[model samples]
Target: MIVHIIKKEIHFRIIKKLCVCFQLLLIVSCQTDDDNPTLPVEDSINGFWFSEELGYILEFTEGNDVVYNINTAGCSIVDDDFELEDFVPSLVSANDLILTTDLNESDFEFTRLSNQNPTCLPDQIADTDDPKVNFDHFWNIFNDYYAFFETRNVDWSQYESLRDQVTTDNFYDILEELVLLLEDGHVSIFDEENGIQIDSGFPKLLETFNMNLSGDFIIENGDDLGDLFGQKATTIVTEYLGGDFEIDERDNILWGLINDTVGYVNVLTMAGYGSDFSNELSTLNDLLDTIMNDISASGVSKLIIDIRFNGGGHDTAALDIVSRFMDQERFLYTKKFRLGNTFTEKRAVSVGPKGDFQFTGDIVLLTSPASISAADLFALCMKDLPYVTIVGENTAGAFSNVLSHTLPNGAEIGLSNEVYEDPQGVIFEAVGIGPDNQENRVPFLSTLDFEEGIDSGINRALELFSN
Candidate 1:
């Protein structure tokens, strides 16, 4: 249950490489140039830059750079000999710079900082390995940024009692216990150097599939839950799909026909498309162009889009895949970032008819608790469409951009820092996005389902279209 759940397609905004990765979506940086603290500025790239998304204070000097992992609790140097990977500027405005980094090779927009945060100042920087200091930083990181304590029905204060109990020997144990109490799929605490990665969400994710990868997710059997991705793909291809059946090289998408009448497309993930990460959207659009063209040519009257195992990726990729199924524009959902005790203004998100070819036929969107983050966003937007009927179980319900931080001891932590809700202001944080019809609900990889080679989600689509 504690195995670090890493995101295959790294979200550049988080401290992904610092610990491990977690599947996530992106959001606009929370700060503006106007929010910068007033100080002197250099017209060159060598200056202070701040990224609320990455939770880092970046300082660039002659030929060297320094990165300070920051949060409301405190700040600490990530390492004595650390530098931002491939930190070359791609764009520079008055006080803004877009720099490409090794995190998925994505260009990130960073706001030029005039001065450092008070907590990150040299004199105030937390540089000790004290377990209590690390504990304070860890607890405060959540106190300041976690957005779902109320929604998840967990009292954050409950952990205050453990603050006094923290010790160097029990530091990791205490942190792991606190992490599990939060019950968030996006939350993770890790010490890469110590080979310790605690994923609070992995057990539940495995439980949704009835897998025993953690000996606690569901049953007693022990198996790598990650294998289920390939197993599920193999089962669908060998047992149910036909026609131009094919899986892309990246294994992110699989498409074909069900009985050569109903269209079938399973998006295993929303991002990580091609050779170039910077042009990921372009690459995906081109692929979508080809797939939509084929679907149009195939003349399938109905479709089943199975995103049951999509853990998440970029939100853009999620929307790109779904827009091809719409007949018109739709106001999808809204998101708000976590401020101190409250949140920022809600931002509306929408999608319109996209791509040269559109599939306006009936669409059955198969979802499960395995569908998370960007996948949750995909389900939320699709739920608003009249032509699409969501089937299967509810989504994983963790919808937010993951914000990363580091403890005083250099341990990396990530937590949900935003909340996404439908257009009507309905949030599905812990409860998940439910199916429009569950009569067709089926365990995709359960022991019985797997042994019998069953994929009732597809069978349900066939049953619905036949009616």
Candidate 2:
């Protein structure tokens, strides 16, 4: 009987080994071609790539410009001039050319551009298409072109696989994966028609709830919260939850009630100059009114200004906000950094010989992993003050701001044009500001308790002020 059992076990082991070998072979068969073909190095490129979507052919001239030649029913049309310096060849097949101005040439893939189908936009999305065949390509693009390339610290291979698996599951799932794939504040996916927005704000803010992106969050297992942002882990619980379930006009993400207190403000960019551009005077007027008339009357001594979602609006906003707190010139905090070859720009806050509203109370500003641009400037200005306490994780640290522009082919590129510094001659461009108190609510997951909760940074602010 023992001899018969041993023979049977050996046969089963052989079958298992064969199954493993077959799986390895199947994976290898599905891999993309890695062979780099040999080509004659050219001095310059002057050729065309076919686009079927816009019904035009884009050709490059040696004079550093791209011109569109319209083709209707395969017939030529009128010509329009364009610029192609930002046009990096999409390497798909063997037909794409990587044109370099400095006499360097490489070959990438070239696909006949498809017609601009509006339905392909994520909101109106329907079925599987060729472009949806891969998320790995987008991941590669993020690694190549993201603003904070070296600092993001993501595992490229894993992110690529994760996004690829969920691109077509549903609307919210795809967006959640995309945000995680590109966590940097500056990196965003935009739709041309709906405008560049993440949260579609429409429905009125609600009260007393737990919400997630997948839809109306169902409290499970005796009222225990399940998934939060994407399909990751169980949610952090909350007490007094209130907000709205609105869709932002931008058509990005679905907003639940828990998303109300966190306002959605996009800086759009942060590369301009001068004090007048920041619109600081206006923001301060509103803030001061909130503190004096609203908060003080409501018996609320503490205030939480959420700048974590801010994407660097203007430098003047930072300076103007700080000016409100500077009682003495010695107490003023100021710093400057060189902006390329132009005049050196002041990055911190100082006493501007003005006080919009002087309140002898404590202030706590909530920052996060995404607070950037002018908002970052504001947090840094209040970093050293006794009355002001910054709560949350470090700033987004996107110090080197960019001026971005779009190409005719719908590809957008940004150029980093300036440098900024913190007080005492310290440059904090790539490096962000660390909070006085490090507490945070992870994006898309933690339910914010307006009353009391461990993960609530706003509660931390109130705690600081109450003490």
Candidate topping TM-score: 1
Estimate the TM-score of every prediction: 0.83, 0.40
What is the Cα-based lDDT of residue 446 in candidate 1?
Answer: 64
RMSD of each: 6.1, 20.6
Please give the range of 10 consecutive residues that has the lowest summed lDDT in model 1: 10-19
Q: Encode model 1's per-residue lDDT on 137-237: one tens digit a residue.
A: 88887887788888877888878778799998999998898888777888887677898978787666556666422333234222444454456566777
Alpha carbon deviation, residue 58, candidate 2 (Å)? 25
Would you list the C-alpha lDDT of every candidate in the order shown? 0.69, 0.36
Candidate 2 lDDT by residue in tens digits, 1-467: 00000000000010011000000000000112246432332332345554322222444456543323221111221123444322333232345432211110111122334432332223532222223332433343333333333345545445554544554345334644554443433433433442433321001001112332123444332112212211211111122123222222221112222222222111212221223323324544454444344333444433445454344544544554455555555333344322222334343434443444543346666665445655666667767667666666667655433322222223222222234555566656546776643243333224333112334564555455546
Report how far off residue 17 is in candidate 2 (Å). Answer: 51
